[model samples]
Target chain A: MSGADVLLLALGAVAVGAGALVVTTRHLVRAGLHLVVCLGAIAGLYLVLGAELVAWVQVLIYVGAVVILLLFAVMLTRAPIGPADDLDRAAWPAALVGAGSGLGLAALFVSAYGWRAVEVAEPGTAGLMGDRIFGSWVLPFEVVSVLLLAALIGAIVVSRPDIGAKDAKERAR
Target chain B: MIRPVVPFVVAALLFGLGVYGVLRRRNAVLVLMAVELMLNAVNIVLVTADTTVRAAVRDAGLTHTGGVFALFVVVIAAAEVGVGLAVILQLYRLRDTVVVDDLDLDAEPEGAR
Candidate 1:
């Protein structure tokens, strides 16, 4: 195996392991921390795969914004900092399905592309990504901005019950 | 050259773990974290496919489709988390619990009836 292949495999191991911990760990905050590790490893995977922009974006968004938001939610909800016994439900069914699908897909991938090696492409730098985004993906980019706006408004509206209550009171008057 | 299947298998396992977390976790925030896991798995697949498949199809019109899609997925994930957390907070306010199992869709709110 080439150095890149070894690196890819190692990083993938770290990612999957951390992801497992994220799900199974009883500590709510620890789960968020584990998610940070998992996402960082995946960002490394993206870098190895020659997607520099996507890798950094993963780091910026997933590891930075998303994980922080999750940790904040955990704190706001008053979840236990230490391990909690009631975090998980029965294990058998979840384990059965998880293992079945994971192994099944792994087997399928192994069979379909057994030992096949592919040449690595040029790394996708920000300049190239920008060109593509502004060139062909501008419409979708605008749509995403709109989506973000809507999500912002929706979140604000959903979290504050007084907004709805005020409107109802005004209508009743 | 890296075997393309390596990343594929990793993504598959990650997704499976995500599924397990979603089903097994009682906390809604934890469930959202699991969903993020699944989204990351998909991003891995997309980035890997962009690398391998683009190498093969050198002259394809849209060479960065997968990477672009992965970017869009990231944006969508951010939005989803924001809205999701808001809803979760609202639920916590109303019911004082974030346990997924405790949520009953069929039942009306105590005052609604």
Candidate 2:
């Protein structure tokens, strides 16, 4: 294995471990923190895989935007940052299902690939990504921007402070 | 040589953990967090597959397709979380709790008041 492969393996392990912690941790803030770690490691993995644009995008979107949104939601909702007695349901069933699916998928992958190696090509650079995004994928790119706009408007409408009043007025009629 | 299967396997496991969190977590926010994990896992697989294919076939057009797809997924996931958090906040406002178990699926809205 080359140095890049080893680094990729280490990052993957970090990602997997931190992802597990995101689910298993009792503290809500800590879980969010773990998610940061998990996502950061995944970004590192993306870097190792030679997708520089995706890696930076992962760091910016997942680590920066998404987690901050989560933290804001957590605080705004007044969710308990510390351990709550009822935050988790029964553990055994989840564990069993999770482990079963994980191992099953792993086995399937191993059997299908059987230690086969695929050569790593030239890395996907930002410039190439931009060209393609503007070239053929422009429609989807524009669509995503529209989606973000709609989501923003919808979220504001949905969470409006006057929603209860509107509901009450509708109910009275 | 970097085996493409390694990343694929890791992606699967991450997805499994995400499924576990979604299934077992009572907190709505936690479930959303798990959903992110699942999304990331999918991204990993896509990028890995893209790399392997590009290496083997050497097609320029097909080169960064998967990466671009993954980028779109990330963007959409952000939008999803934004809307999701808004819904969660609304639920919290209405019910004063974020626990999924605490939601009354069958309860009448009129009766709730």
Which candidate number would show the highest lDDT if scored against the true structure? 1
> Which digits, one per residue and each the tens of the lDDT, describe model 2 over residues B8-27?
88899999999899989999
**Candidate 2 chain A, which ten residues in sequence have the lowest lDDT sum?**
A160-169
Give me the TM-scores for chain A across all models, comma-separated: 0.94, 0.90
* Regions of candidate 1 where Cα sits further than 4 Å from its true position: A170-173, B106-113
In the order shown, the candidates' Cα RMSDs to the true structure are 1.9, 2.1
Q: What are the models' TM-scores?
A: 0.95, 0.93
Q: Residue A30, candidate 2: how far off, in angstroms?
A: 0.1
Model 1 per-residue lDDT tens digits across residues A1-173: 99999999999999999999999998899999999999999999998898999999999998999999999999999988788998889998998898888889889888988988998877888988988899889999999989999999999998877777867778889
Q: What's the residue-level lDDT of B9 in candidate 2?
A: 86
True contacts kept of each: 0.82, 0.80
Q: Candidate 2 lDDT, tens digit per residue, A34-109?
A: 9999999999888878789999999998999999999999899897766877789998998899888888888887
Clash number by candidate, in order: 0, 0
In model 1, residue pairs whose N, Cα or C atoms come closer than 3 Å (at least 3 residues apart or on different chains), thus clashing, are none
